[model samples]
Target: MEQAQMPGCYRHPGVETGVRCTRCERPICHACMVDAAVGFQCPECVRDGSGTGHSRTANQPRTIAGGRITAGHPHLVTQVLIGLNLLIFLLGRLNPALIDETVLIGFAFDPDLGRVVGVADGEWYRLVTSMFLHQEVWHIAGNMLLLWLLGGTLEEELGRVRYLTLYLLSGLAGSAFTYLIAAENQGSLGASGAIYGLLGATVVLVRRLNRDMRPIMALVVINLVITFAWDGIAWEAHIGGLIAGVILAYAMVNGPRERRALLQGAACALVLGLTLATVVLRTAALT
Candidate 1:
């Protein structure tokens, strides 16, 4: 039982394997190889074999992890966040009373500058919790739809865990800002803050990748306009989220090489600290 010797570049034989497809495990020649996010794939197998059995090659581009990866795929974190938001929306619809009693409890902003300066009470969890709650059907729909559009691509670009961290932190930032500015109000809910964060991340990444961002810029401006024009919109949350996103993107995605991961990790930490501080002040003020 001896393994067959691979050809000079083939690495696999008996089937005239020219080069290996990086994505799917198929033998292909230089002529048939298709470049992929992490590596090269055999065009024939990718096209003919239902797109399975992919393997990475050294010649393909590698991330900091030293492997080929996929982009724009929905990572588990994004899926879970989306599911949670939808579930909450459905439950709210089913039990109108639940929505009413819990609306403020679950998603309202509470500012406590006194607490920040050691004078009042606060509820720190609101920074993160507020991200999960939404007020109206259209609110959730718009947020979730934007999340579906931008989150998957971001998760793929940054990998699952990092992407999740960025998203949560951005949401928290949005919530905290709302609390700080609107502490006198009952509270606020929606994914717009987080969605704005995604937009911020996109703008940074697009610039880093050297891709034209005219389209993304246009989209962002349109959303901003809508946010300001619509009385129902939480423009504060959007701005906070956008700021957090830009910071995270700058930290996570500003390098010629594999620095995106490092920047992203740093951004996540910064967001966590800032949002937690806001939450603690708010909670202490409340109590």
Candidate 2:
């Protein structure tokens, strides 16, 4: 007796799969399988309906990452993020202490709070909170405006879940990078890191779609110049977020149709793990 090799997906030739599309009997990987009334169907069968009098499958409308296509305010996640940032900023204004407590720092002695506080001191929440903190109107304004412009399209294109994951992980990666290299007492807070991540993601998306690339490329170059030229800007966060976003967006958009979700999830996990490791190493160095 001889063993037969598993067949690959019709659309993705690289994924080894044992399942076949019920409609056309073509092999399909999980990424390309669309649920049907009878059984799973391939994307082509799901799209055309093949004059079989079958209604369009409920699972037909999917994003580039296989996320469900949301109707009516597809950018809901983006809207919520902006709203939350604004609300936090307002709170910080009302209670200036909130800014002191939340701003990103590896380690710092807070004279007002009369205590040593920082990520190394176990206030790790700062990594996330700092992304939403802004003392200056100009800082928040610039960030929110960029988020509105870039986030809406990216959210719609990548769908809510992937877009949110990319945003958060990018922000965390930025915070981790800042903690790893920036002076322990150095204070940094802003959404610029996350926005830069979106900027990098936009570049990847534009490239994937084969659209004109000059505008996005120019935007990135200009921001890089600003990141380095400016005195207070955290260049570490910007570079870290940009790199994480590029890696994640590439995985999200171009993961092979065979086990694509698994691959993308692994990429996300890799970023998170590396970021966590970096933070831990820095914490040890500080202590």
Q: Residue pairs in steric clash, candidate 2?
A: none
Residue 275 lDDT in candidate 1 = 74
Q: How many residue pairs clash in each candidate?
A: 26, 0
In candidate 1, stretches whose alpha carbon ends up further than 4 angstroms from where it belongs are 1-76, 97-122, 256-262, 281-287
lDDT of 1 by residue, 149-255 (tens): 89877876555665766687777788777776664444567777888998999898777555678999998999999999998666778999999988987776554
RMSD (Å) per prediction: 10.3, 7.3
Q: lDDT at 239 for candidate 1?
A: 95
lDDT assessment of candidate 1: 0.64
Give the per-residue lDDT digits (tens) of candidate 2, residues 1-287.
Answer: 89998886775555678888777899987766777776677766766665244527437646667776665787899999999999999999999999899999989899988999999999989999999999999989989998999999899768899999999999999999999989999999999889989999999888866567899999899989999998899999999999999999988888676676988899899999999999889999898
Work out candidate 1's RMSD over C-alphas: 10.3
How much is the lDDT of residue 119 in candidate 2? 97
